[model samples]
Target: MIASYEMKHQVPYYECDATGHQTLAMLFRLLILASEDHSDALGVGTAKIKEYDGGWVIINYAGDVDRLPRENETVTIKTYVEAYNRFFVVRTFEVYDADGKQLVKVKGMFAFMNLTTRKVASIPEPLIVPYQSEESRRLPKVARPQLMANDLAWERLDYRVRFFDIDLNNHVNNAVYFDWLLDPLGGEFLRHHRLVNLKMKYDHEVRAGEKVDSQFIKIEEKNQIITHHQIQCQGKIAAEAEFEWKLV
Candidate 1:
């Protein structure tokens, strides 16, 4: 059995931004696709989830990017199940350029939620045993993203959840949250700065037609710009993320 799954992907034009490099959000999308493909190989993908009326939901994600692949560049994404518990699983990802230079490394925590209950469910042994993944009694954890100060002056943008933002699980796709979090930064910042690292936490799910408020505050450190973002829906925090960027 393969210990890890890997696939090659060409960075497409639409996935790049004005800077001609893959956007931070698109990197996440690619990682997600790689993860899905890996799960399918392990026989625990969408079809398997349906067998239990459950779906995988990301709880936390943290990653560091040495460089972002440019348009048309072929990159390889490799993924493996690092560990898991009854309710949560940890997965790791590595992205490499065609020359085999590593570009990014990421870790994510996810939980299987019962569709009807909308609550975490124990992963079935059939699903867990196939991958020969390490099992632990405790949930795999990732560092929580820094919270933005409520009193700080924040730039806010409002958006209505669109159909395209919804995924098969019927909630706003996790990748879309990065868009909502960063778009408020505007073109100038996005064009001149490149994301170096990020940590994100999903607090609640946003449904289609719901209005969301994206708020952020930027803080400049010696060589990096750290932006704290919050997305709120229906008076509750839906998601939060911290992004670290460097001048390109």
Candidate 2:
């Protein structure tokens, strides 16, 4: 029985960037691994998801990193179920330093989807039972993106379409957008506060050869920062989004 699994991990050198800190993309990957571990513990790993003719697909995710894990540092990821809606489940992650202090917190919304049909499906009862926890509480109210905000404006950020960014979906991978957004801020912000939250709204498809603009709106009262990405052809908002970043 994988009761309350724990694993120690040393940050790999390759996962670090020029600043000698773990890359945002790599951090996301680590969290994915932790989630898989949780599935294994509950005996509902990916194979079981497939067995039910259903699979888990990330619909939306918001996370905040408080500090960047340096090279060779051992960090622990503790995760648990926060809540579940009819079509979506909210999972949370807490990353800790070797000393056990919290470093990063991630919350994601996942949908049970029919792989073949590529559509949302009702979560199976057996699947949900094991994942549920008596201590699991309702997730905190998150500030969602506003499709239209008067204070928000789009700033064009041009990215050359790269062959590698295209995933099996034939579109830019969702995680790649984080690189685009976080890279602009440089490693300073990432190195400072651990990411406590990140909200991403994929408004439209990003294809090769298309230039895009990322927009931002500051909502300090809520300790939240919002951003948008748009595909610009002749300077029009083809796609738009707002993201909330909460400080840990």
Give all TM-scores, in the order shown: 0.94, 0.73
Give all candidates' CA lDDT scores. 0.88, 0.66
The residue-by-residue lDDT of candidate 1 on 1-248, one tens digit each, is 43688989998999988889997778888888888888798788889878999888899998888988999999999988888888888888899998999999889998888989989999888877876778877755677789867899989999999999998768888888888998999999988888888899999989988999999999997876899999999999999999899887
Worst 10 residues of 2 by lDDT: 134-143
The candidate that achieves the highest TM-score relative to the unseen native structure:
1
lDDT of model number 1: 0.88
Model 2, 9-68: lDDT tens digits are 789999988768787778777877888888888898887888888977765566666776
What TM value does model 2 have? 0.73
lDDT of candidate 2 vs native?
A: 0.66
Alpha-carbon runs more than 4 Å astray in model 2 = 1-5, 134-142, 145-153, 166-172, 184-197, 203-248
Give me the runs in candidate 1 sitting further than 4 Å from their true place.
137-141
